[model samples]
Target chain A: MEEQLIECDVLCVGGGIAGLMAAIRASELGANVVVAEKGNPHYSGCGRRGNDHFETWIPEVHGADKEKFIDELLKTAKGEILIGRDILRAQFGKAHEIVELWDEWGIPMRQKGKWEFAGHAFPGRMMTHIKYEGRFQKTVLVQQARKRGARIMDRIMVDELLRDGDRVIGAVGVHTREDTVFVFQAKAVILGTGKCSRLYQGLTPGMMFNDGHGGVQTGDGRAMAYRAGAELMNVEMPQRHIGPKYFAKFGQATWVGVLRDAEGKPVGPFVSEPDRRYGDIVMEVNKLAPEQYGERGRGPVYMDCTGISDKDAAYMRHWHIHEGNVSLVDHMDAEGIDPRKHPIEFSTYPLRGGGLIVANEKAETSLPGLYAAGDEAMGDISAAATFGWISGDTAVAYARTVEHGDVEVTRPIIAALESRIDELRGRGNGPDWEEANIALQQVMTDYAGKVRNEARLLQGLAHLRRLRQKVDTELMARNQHELGRCLEVHNLFDVGELTFHAALDRRESRGLHNRPDYPFKNPLLSQAHIVRMEGDRPVTDWRSY
Target chain B: MPPIINPDLCIKCDRCVNICTEDVFFGSKKHETPVITYPRECVHFNGCVDVCPVPGAIWLRYPMPSMIVYRTSSDYRAPPG
Candidate 1:
């Protein structure tokens, strides 16, 4: 196959909110930019479906005291992780401005004269969020980026970053449909591939059929960065939460409704309250669920929406439909269940790989000319937006200082990547990729998932290592779809191993990294677990917050 | 489930087929009218309806009770005091 090469001043990989923002900022700064997207920019990443609210510290609404706001934000991190204070300050400082930009783009930020906002209640006093009908957020961002003159290459999955010495020059990807290889040469590269969500069973058992994070997020950015010798943090701290069991779509309904026992008695405060983080709420419920729903007890835990007025329920349903889960209501109706009558059943699931690609306030990785943003760069959407904005300007500034280098230096790197793909294609058959993937998911879900102990983690790590060897040599793809799945499994192996090692390294129980053996948060061990590749092995280090 | 396409109203422009990430719509040829080949894959982000040039060419049959909810594209404004 022939190789296709494209040159630009900035190459933004993974065209989610962060990548699009980077491309838009770079283009606005008069830099030639190209966006390589695994899926269409119009509908990719978590932002594609839309979000209910935007979290920003609007001084006018909250306060002008920036120091106080940062302190409050740090409190939410809860000593378990070292959130870059500089990044948090940068995010809060620009919060209102970004919100204004969204509003100027004709995206609604308020339903009425008042902005309905609520904190998860880790610190309830800070109501720095505003509800919005953001179903068209991706469309709006794509339009803005295009208007700023950033060319978008859709369905191009970037598999590796091209480096000359220590600096990243560009990236190499494959066109899933055209069967062509794409080589993007640029002065700067931005990775905004979102988080790794399918590392465990997603939402429900069979519902794992599609990655809960829009079927595209696979820790591709983390995997690529690790291979390039970049540092990643908090690989073990998984985002676990409670949701409607089989019908995870109705999980968000918990935010608006009240939690109840099987007998329909109110059990606890609604999730919208500002007293505790949602994760803590899930932990509380998980303890009570088995006892309350056991055969000896009433039945099953549920989100009781019975009290929600018809008008409010209508509004909620409209919002849910646009979030790409309209099937939730349909499934309910098919089963003769009604939110107005029956309470939705609940279960717990892990959301994504923990604290990811470590970068500075400017979103620049340890490696020069390379930037990380979105879930790969930060933990939340608000921080992702801030990182995206900052990284775009940073990349543009860096581009101005450097000139485009020769593409010949990348030939060896391109050849190596292509050979790997060729080897996969040459393999006739062995263990099925899907079967191996299920085994991988089963190992993580059984051991490293919600529950964790030294013994279980070690056992999971051994199983994952065996699975990784099988995947590297035996996995095969006959078509474009299978090829995409094969690549995803390859990336998942990298993430799974890192997650297990990180889990084993952390000796104390922190916010999300709950180890029954440790059972307590140790002040001495309050540091971020940093992981990086040493040849083929991942080495762990700690950095104090 | 995928957004239901009204064959009568559809101009067969193939806008929905091109925009959907799930490849929900499939046909023998590019110009041929496409059918919803994989409804289960549709997350229903509703980008297809927004891009469709023809009005009423596609509509989602939401579950009952939710059927009463009205879908509109207008921005939320403050109600008259």
Candidate 2:
């Protein structure tokens, strides 16, 4: 297998929403952009399933409440969502511009030329989650990027970033279906590879391919950035989201109905309004509410939409574009169970790996030539898109001032990465990706799951260290696809260890990082964990964001 | 239950094989229909059904646990929005 060296001005490691936005903006700015996508650009990343709404602050709906919008993000998401004011401001400031761009790119954001508002209450509403049919967001973004002359290389699973001294020159990737390795050499690198949830999921034989929001989110981009001498923040906490059973799905219709206990009592808010952070309803339900339920009842909660109008029921059914397993609608329809008539069972699972790592308004990472956007860096779809938009300009400007790294500097980095890939190939029998992945998941779940203490976390770290040794020496991949899985599992190990350490360092419980030893949120430790490698060793330090 | 590919209706277009969002099926060179090699991996997004020219060629049968048939009262309308 020959190594292909592709040179570009800016290399985007993912082709998800952020990557496409970065590429679209960079290419539009006349920078030669190359997006290395692990899956088909038309159907990869988080927005691959499409979303019902993009969480942008719309002025028409909220009366342009900037402080209210920023406050809602920092507070309403269950806890203090340590997001930078700059990132939130960047997203809010350019909200209309991005919406217009999305509308122009054929994503129908407006219905009869008006954004349909949901979730937020009317009078003094702070947030406006605009509704749109986001099923083809990727396809539309891909079409736009291609039209702008940005090359989107599909099935290229980017394994690692290529560092030239302190700056990220480019990245190393493998063809998911072929033996070829793509070594991209660019003046600047922008990572938009979304969040990491599959580490907790990949081993589930039933869920071999899906995450709650994205397809194949293994924290690969985060791992790549960390390994390339970059700092990762807010990753100490992974999130738990509430949704339907069986499928890993979220949003869309899940939040529409009222939650009921077994006794036909309203367990959760009606979500008619003031229902920002609806998970708070579930948590409240899980407690001893004797006055509400007449007894201590917790177990299973059902979402009852029987009271909503036919219009709203139809709206929910219409919103079922399978970002929330759209096929469930067919199942419901076949079973003669209209959700407006039938109460759907709902449960909460570890939804998001919490932490809005640092990528300021300019979309710059700690490293000079690298930018992090979307889930890989910080913020939601809007922030990811906004930073991705900013990354285009920042990455382009940075790319213009520098030349590609000299061949001598890149030669060894490529060689080291190639040797590791070679070692993963053609091994007949050893710990396959599933085996290693399951082992890692077991350790993570046992030690670092909802409840965490020092002893268990320390033990988990030791177990991960042993597992890394086992995977490093005895891991096997039968094919290129298996090879990609193997690499993703390796990334899971890195990220899992990073999270375990981050969890260990943060002494108090806050949001998703629940340290049972120190149960309550500590004002002193109300800071974000920044994880970075200190020359062949990973280190985490609490920093004020 | 995962997505079952019905051989009787499959036209061997390879549409499901190439266009599956989750890559649940392997392209079957030996026959017209594709193989559900990664059946457990199927999240049942139904991209295969959307792409399949033939009706009933591809369909997702979710597990019984996933398909809870709890029917609420048809007349249970009290909480006004």
Error of 1 at A108 (Å): 1.2
Q: Write the per-residue lDDT of candidate 2 for residues A1-545, one digit (tens) a residue.
A: 78898999999988888999999999999999999988777766667667766677777666656778777656545346576577678878886689889998898888779887654332243445677778778779989999999998977888888887887888888987778989888899898888786666432333545446644678888887787878888677776655554444434343456666655676645343223223124432332222224334554566666666777666666677724346667777777877665666655544345354467788888888999898777746777777888899899999989988864577777787678788889577898987898788778887888678999999989999999999999999887777888888988898888888888888888766778898888898766678889979878877776
True contacts kept of 2: 0.38
Q: After superposition, how far is residue A347 of candidate 2 from its true place, in Å?
A: 0.6
True contacts kept of each: 0.11, 0.38
Each predicted complex: what DockQ? 0.10, 0.33
Question: What is the Cα-based lDDT of residue A387 in candidate 2?
Answer: 80
